[model samples]
Target: MKRNFLLLLIFVLVVIAISEGIGFQSIPIGKFNIGLLPLVFAIIITMVLGIRIFRKGIIKKIYSKENVNFASKYLIFIMLPLMARYGADVAPKLKEILSIGWVFLIQEVGNLGTVVLGLPIALLIGLRREAIGATLGIGREGELAYISEKYTLESPEGRGVLSLYIIGTLFGAIFFSIFAPVLLDLGFRVEALAMASGVGSGSMMTAASSTLVARMPELGETIRAYASASQLLTSFLGTFTMVFLAAPLQKFMYGLFIRGEK
Candidate 1:
């Protein structure tokens, strides 16, 4: 386990080194600036290395099964301090966040939009029990924890959430990197986009805010503060929103769908 941890740390450090070396870059498309942060590169590089193309070759040794399990167990600890830092981003914008207090609180109800809209689509696509997990939310850390606690990680619901969790982790940041800029291009306010960028996932928030900052350098600090503040609120509220609202609502919808099919 010690050796596996060391290997994981070494690989992470190497990736960080490479990303910092590349720094930040962007492209101009008329009024829009497509920012390219080192984050996108690191995700691509890490994913490419872990792909099946290298599975039977060199990376097999680098990402041994033991090391994979070891790393997963400790990944939470690694994210703890980083989440705190994200929360700290709210300090400078404390007044702003307080003024928009009702917005943050009301927006939490929107979290259930995933399950409300996704359940029927999921069922139509032949997803049964799994629909409960996948549609509960974006399947981030909060949903994963909720599903695992209520149904255990080995349950059908657990598989549903885990599937989305993996997909979100891998591609959500990239999606936000592109999506935020597109929204900005479409004439959305930077402040609005920044708040929306807080999808309750740290990586995705960073990607979304980075792109906005890189494009509108004058609003960089404001963008970060708004994004981090929104993220902090959503993440904190997302869990309760899930347990109290999404869960019961999913049950009702799933029951309704089952009856209709019958």
Candidate 2:
């Protein structure tokens, strides 16, 4: 009940932020913005775990198989980028279907850029291949829900998962922000490639990426238009990919690692 309340509160706060246009415009700390929404969500999740730990004392017995399962699912944090890329790729179909026209493409390209920058890092970190599909939300929703119900991660365990996600996402972002310029200087920049492949199912990230890319001069005026075009393309296909692929991938991973465990 308490956990549910916490989540509800966080949802309310997010709604308020959206309605009021409150955003991460102010930098409170280095590399960490004073965005109320993301921070609130992160805090609420942590609070749930803290409360759980306080209520139920620690258990010493280790279930290595279960731990592996948790760890593998924990890797779904990588979806942060995949979602962006997917959103980028599906935007065009959205424009045609909704008649929103050509303006939505910027968001898509930036989203793809973010994905290209982030997914490779996730792969490098030894994330399970099946886990990657889930992170991208590729046919994984029902499976994730099922896994969440059957293999409950207590608050303490959940805290670890959230932390892994936060760390992984931040590292991926920071690496991209810092290294992208260096790569550009070496004439090896792949911003367009990133823009093409990175945007996934997350519209918000795609929009954010579009805004960021628009500020870069090297992307060219035509490129800005293309980014918007790409976002439109991503929004349509990405959603379908998520519906079809997420579950089977998770099951495949389970078979590979947590075989026959209850």
Which candidate should be chosen as best, given TM-score against the real structure?
1
Residue 196 local lDDT, model 2: 43
Per-residue lDDT tens digits for candidate 2, residues 1-262, read 3444454446546555653464333333543332223333343343454353443422111212353355356655855676455445445444442454333444433333222443345445655432333243312233234334544434332333344444444343333333333333445434453344234323233333433343354654333344444444555644544344433443454455545642
- In terms of lDDT, the best-performing candidate is 1
- In order of appearance, the predictions have TM-scores of 0.90, 0.36
Tell me the whole-model lDDT of each prediction, alpha carbons only: 0.85, 0.40
Name the runs in model 1 displaced over 4 angstroms: 27-33, 56-58, 260-262
How does model 2 score by TM-score?
0.36
Model 1, 1-262: lDDT tens per residue?
6765676778889998998799787767887767778898888888999987776654676688887777678878877887887767778878977988888777778888998899999999999988888999999889998999989889889999999999988898888887788788889999989988887888889899998998899988789888888788888888888889999999999999888542
Ten contiguous residues with the weakest lDDT in model 1? 53-62
* Global fold similarity of model 1 (TM-score): 0.90
